[model samples]
Target: MAHVLVVEDDRPTAEAIASELRAHGYSVDTAGTGADALALAQAATPDALTLDRLLPDTDGLALLAKLREVGIHAPVLMVSALGDVDQRIAGLRAGGDDYLIKPFAPSELAVRIEVLLRRTRPEAETVLQIGRVRIDRIRREAQVAGEPVRLLQMEFKLLEFLMRHAGATVSRRMLFEQVWNYHFDPGANLINVHIARLRRKLDMPGEPSAIVTVKGEGYRFDAV
Candidate 1:
């Protein structure tokens, strides 16, 4: 069973989420303050975390930054009443794997948690190689033929997902769901934009592109 550390300051809200998760066969623990949350996280090392934006002791983003700085790599689902796009971006920038706005259904939360957990699970191979690109999953870094390639967080994630399913046709819908954790069609161009950026970084002058676009379908990472 996967363990979840739920950090919510509201007593009833915390219990409600915990109860729901327990009903779904997950081990749940709750912390009402950031300090306690950090302590519990270090001691127990939960498989996932649900962080509330507002806490009595400290902001959830601050705690998240500290956790990342210390190498706590568990997936984080940040929940906040603030539904602004900027806030969502901030949470994602602060190491949140996913963000949930307030008034969301428990089922939605469950689905998001499941996706996050699955995405963070360790793969059999620590490093994935395809064509000239080498991805170090452990260090979350990528390289092109021994030259280190700097990738933004989302770009790295996009590349990693494609490399994991290398030599297979990956639909845009699947990419959106797996990489962005959104169950709906965000847009073809949105994913295309990221792929374009990654392509620029991963490809060298006069070299074959690592990612191939499958017209009317999705993308395929070439297997060398």
Candidate 2:
């Protein structure tokens, strides 16, 4: 079970959410103030966070900035009644991974929370090697040859996922759904864009490309 920190000022509302999440078998901690929530997050480092936009003590955006400054990398899902596109975009830009408006169904909240948690921690597999590049799943780290290599957020996730089942051809549909969290694209160029970025970054300086594109199928990474 994953731990979730939920920050909301309303006592009844916060308890209600915590109760629902706990019923779903998740460990949940509730905070009624931004200060309290930040303290709880620092102490426990919950797997993910559900932040309320209106905190009695301080601006939620400022609180989020403080959390980011403290290196809290857990995915954040913002709860707010503000449904304007600008507000939503602002939340995203402020490091919120997802947002749900007030009056949301408990089922929707539960599903979204599960998705965020899963995104944080995927199914663990053994070490994956694609050509000369090796990735350790537990650490979510990659290496080219013997030296370490750093990957962008999406790049690392995409590569980590492919390496899990090296040599098994994976369809773009599966990749988009599993990696990008988007399963509804009629045709997604996102796969192509991320792959190209990964290729340029990973296969540079005499490095052989490990990602293979299968026409009419999808892509696969082969361990060599």
Candidate 3:
């Protein structure tokens, strides 16, 4: 899965973008300031970045230059309220792969980041594997222990999301948003029912379920 760093000072906007990216299966890290963003980028380079054009401490262009100096050459999608042609050009000239004007749809932002990632990493993996399970994204197939596993459309999507986030806790709300495309929780056992069916198919007799429930929080997919 692709990893993206979101650098935006606006708390609500940052959270909204981060949530949207996470729902789309990209691991995301958020920073409210330039210093924090630089620190995060240095510690663990992201595949791409969604940088706010106007940060509180420094101009986005300056931060971009700093990142380059430190050898972090990830593509950047600059987000700004300045939608004027001149401002957009400046952002592009400053190493922004793309510029998104404010008031834009979060879905569109995700797509733009995806496009950037594609351009930079054309060979991104299409198949996902964890332990004995494997899934081909292009062929829409799943296997456990080298044997085929039949799955309905919805079940495949759920499994894909879980596999992409292997070893991480996935919230029920996240599953609902990403898998079911539902913005609000239905307040039902819809996810539980589907997951139970999936567990039965993927689990071998006398083996533990791959998906583990984290009481009061959500489910964690054990990589093992």
Candidate 4:
């Protein structure tokens, strides 16, 4: 299980966030102030963190800088009531991996954290296997049912990321950020075009496509 630290001053909000994360199988620790948050983080580094922009003791950006200065490199999701473009940009500039505005769904928060964790965790194995699809990282090759599949550089990267998180839903935003190194959503059909092409190459003649669209949400890569 992944460990997460949630720092928020509002008691009810903190509890709700913690509860949601625990339900998602994460080990959670909560702090109502920056001092306490720093102490907990220094004592035991967490895998991820959720930080509120306003705290009783310190500003979220300052706290984030402090954490980085102390060598706690956990991915942070900044939660705040401030939804201005500048505020959001500042949060991201301060080392936040993602940001969620107030009144957001707890489930969405969990999903964002999930993405953050996926991005930061190191893949120790050189090869990844999911059902019939497999990729050899060292060789930069992909195979399906033991048959070689020719892939371009971008296709290989997209496939590797999708396979790494098989059975989980990945939004276009997540894909753009992780696979294409895009911080802002392009709002274009670029991903759709690539996904369509990938399906053509990856799917067997009579078998269903391995990638399933999760209507209104994102895409999920089925194991088979």
* Residue 5 CA displacement from its true place in model 2, Å: 0.5
Q: TM-scores of the models, in the given order?
A: 0.57, 0.57, 0.56, 0.82
> Pick by lDDT: which candidate is best?
4
Shift of residue 194 alpha carbon in model 4, Å = 1.0
Ranking by TM-score: 4, 1, 2, 3
Error of 4 at 55 (Å): 2.9
**Candidate scoring better on lDDT of 1 and 3:** 3
RMSD of each: 10.3, 10.9, 9.3, 2.9
The prediction achieving the highest TM-score against the true structure is 4
CA lDDT scores, all candidates in order: 0.85, 0.80, 0.87, 0.89
Off by over 4 Å in 3: 124-224
Residues 1-224 of candidate 4: C-alpha lDDT, one tens digit per residue: 99999999999999999998998899999999999999999999999999999998899999999999999999999999998889999999999989888977676688789878977876589999888888899999989989999998998888887887677777776788778988787889878988888898889988888999988767888977
lDDT of 1: 0.85
Using lDDT as the yardstick, the better of models 1 and 4 is 4
| Candidate with the larger TM-score of 1 and 4 | 4
TM-score of 3: 0.56
Consecutive 10-residue window with the lowest summed lDDT within model 3: 165-174
lDDT of 3 by residue, 95-208 (tens): 988887888768668766775887787757999899888999889999988999999999999998788666666767667766797746799999999999889878888877
